[model samples]
Target: MDNRDAVSAFLRSRRERITPEQAGLPVYGQRRVPGLRRGEVAALAGVSVEYYTRLERGNLKGVSDSVLDALAQALRLDDTERMYLYDLARAAGPAPRARARQREVRPAVRPSVARIVEGMPELPAFVMNNRLDTLAANSLGRSLYSQMYADSTCGANVARFAFLEPAARRFYADWERMARFAVGALRIEAGKNPYDRELSNLIGELSTRSDDFRVMWGSHDVHVFRESTKRLNHPLVGVLELDQETLSLPDETGLSVVVYSAPPGTAAEDSLKLLASWSATTGQDQHTESASEPSDRHL
Candidate 1:
């Protein structure tokens, strides 16, 4: 998708969410649209209606930071939305020379990184790149997301599992909300890395295959990942209310570690322990099977 269209759609979506009353504007006549009129937005931003109209029509190139800030204030955008606006603006600018390097998908994970995930035995932790590809995960992490790993065709893609796999509907308690959040996170990543071919392809595939994904993607929402509570209906351990913490790996750009945990003495914590036990048993069985296999040299 073109950056200009993204910019226009994002701004329009933000504008359409705020009513005149919410914007502290006096309601006058019958409103034709749901939110504040273009003129009202321009007035609130202290800009000309024509200029704001141009901006809303996908012309954000060369726009000053001050004007953007004013527009953001008028729209009452939060920090995440404001950052997304900046990302879209940067994307609309001249293409960078290093974009080709940035577009490379599936960067190799360092052994140390994998070890770090493995070290966190109690918590279900996994490392994923910006494209939401699961590069490395602990045993419990793998167990927690067993459904995603069940189908090799999907690989370790959280987005594909969420939208394409039927198990996702059963795994995530709030399936629709999780789906929207996943798409929004992907949208944010797309704005930051427009040249990412893999991300583009994934978006295309999801849009083509899932009608719900297509509709949510069309909304142009953006989300910044942070700590959140998730309710998972695990097939083995039943329900679990886990808290998620997403930590960025500074050395590895575009990669982050997501760890899931529950409070002490909670039923969720007991469920997590049960899950860990199951994972341990499963791992031992797999290890034994691999060890029992006859070596080619012996044969």
Candidate 2:
């Protein structure tokens, strides 16, 4: 969780996976290792071997933004990977100038947003934070995630459920895919707000409790949950395949609303209709998830 450990692990993992040939460098007959060496990456990034070695050794304090970008490029980082690199560097480098606090999520639940969800009664929709905390859900959204409300604790966190609850694994047919998305989203948040006390504690608890979470976290496979396909199991309506659209609130920080829909005439579409019906009959409920899952798994 420290910058030093995060930097060392992230770079080492990325470097170990990329081959010299893939970077278009000559593999030559005598090469033994699979990926580019430290010196090789340093050369590609236009930095001295000694400096790059220092960087890899957890000495990222005072590293320049340009240098970080160079390393990201040399490593052939994707959007998520590149962002994570910068986040780590930012965390380790010089103290940031104090500025206004950016919550990044609209705290107010807009009436218009609720109206929109109400209009699409058949679709399952809800709002969540960068930290994956559920803020609001429409009627159908409540039914779609009925299991989440099976408990008395009016509030529950999804990440806690995904890793700690066995039912979550069973609930999500595509458990592994969902889990990866969860990890990726969490990674992005970690980079965005490294010092968030709750987040830090959550990560710490998970790291101690879930081996799988820790492994993926260490790998630093940062990702954004902009859009995704999901498979959900419903008690009354069976299973559904829904296409989801996640819209970030431009007016707020860390808040985004997601809606899940199925094309007309599909069974999933019909299932969604059933969810709405169920919600109309049964009042909305609350969910309490197991928040003590371990977060340790080798990435």
Candidate 3:
């Protein structure tokens, strides 16, 4: 999982997606490729062809911020894509600095964070890492994603569940759209943390196990999860159209708290109330079952 390969693929993908006309460049006769040629992009960015060629070859080392900005402008990169490009360049810096940037991302949730999630009894809230692992979840959050939790194969990873679980298709109303967003988000994380072994393994596993993931991963799209509406078909509570908000922790832990809520006076709101009640009842039953288990001495 060399970062060079990622850099090369991302640049080429972005380049090949744009046409000369899109970039307001005059097209020459019989263009071999659909996108603006390297020279055209270089000219647009006010860089020499050789320099842009060197960048496209994945050697972003010692790249300047102004040049990166110029490239981003020439490529028409959106905010998220621009951030990803900057991250890739930073990762391409000196070995010691890059290593310093690669800090160990702890998967454990802080007690205060867990308490905050638990305190939000009305909303389904969970804490997740950059890898899309649901590290901690409130009772309602767990209930909301019961299908994902039931399938132990993904180990509570959202990306894995979306790609690897068959039930996911039925669980999400807009399966294809959600899957693409998930893929895009994962791609962004990969760009930020290229040295993470767990993330690499997760991407490799998804690529190997799911054809849809493999195809979507090839697009080189990027996304940052902020706020979105998710239409979910829960087995227990039926349809739930919830608005999800992702808030990043202030620290460099790469952890975020995702909270889902429904608008008042909507059917989704009614469903959430019912789901909360059901979650409470089920949780009590599980607690009772644990308490009633026979002791080792008795056995």
Q: Give lDDT tens digits, candidate 3, residues 98-169.
A: 553454435456677878888887798878777777767777887888777764422278787788888899
RMSD of each: 5.9, 4.9, 5.8
Among all windows of 10 consecutive residues in model 1, the one with the lowest summed lDDT is: 290-299
Error of 1 at 262 (Å): 2.7
Cand. 2 TM to true fold = 0.84
Candidate number with the higher lDDT (1 or 3):
1
Deviation of model 3 at 79, angstroms: 1.1
Instruction: Please state the error at residue 298 of candidate 3 in Å.
Output: 36
TM-score for all predictions? 0.89, 0.84, 0.90
Quote the positional error of residue 284 for candidate 1 in Å. 6.8
Q: Candidate 3: list runs displaced more than 4 Å.
A: 96-102, 105-107, 153-155, 284-299
Which candidate's lDDT is highest? Answer: 1
Question: How accurate locally is residue 206 in candidate 2, as Cα lDDT from 0 to 100?
Answer: 73
* Descending-TM-score candidate ranking: 3, 1, 2
**Model 1 whole-model lDDT (C-alpha atoms):** 0.80
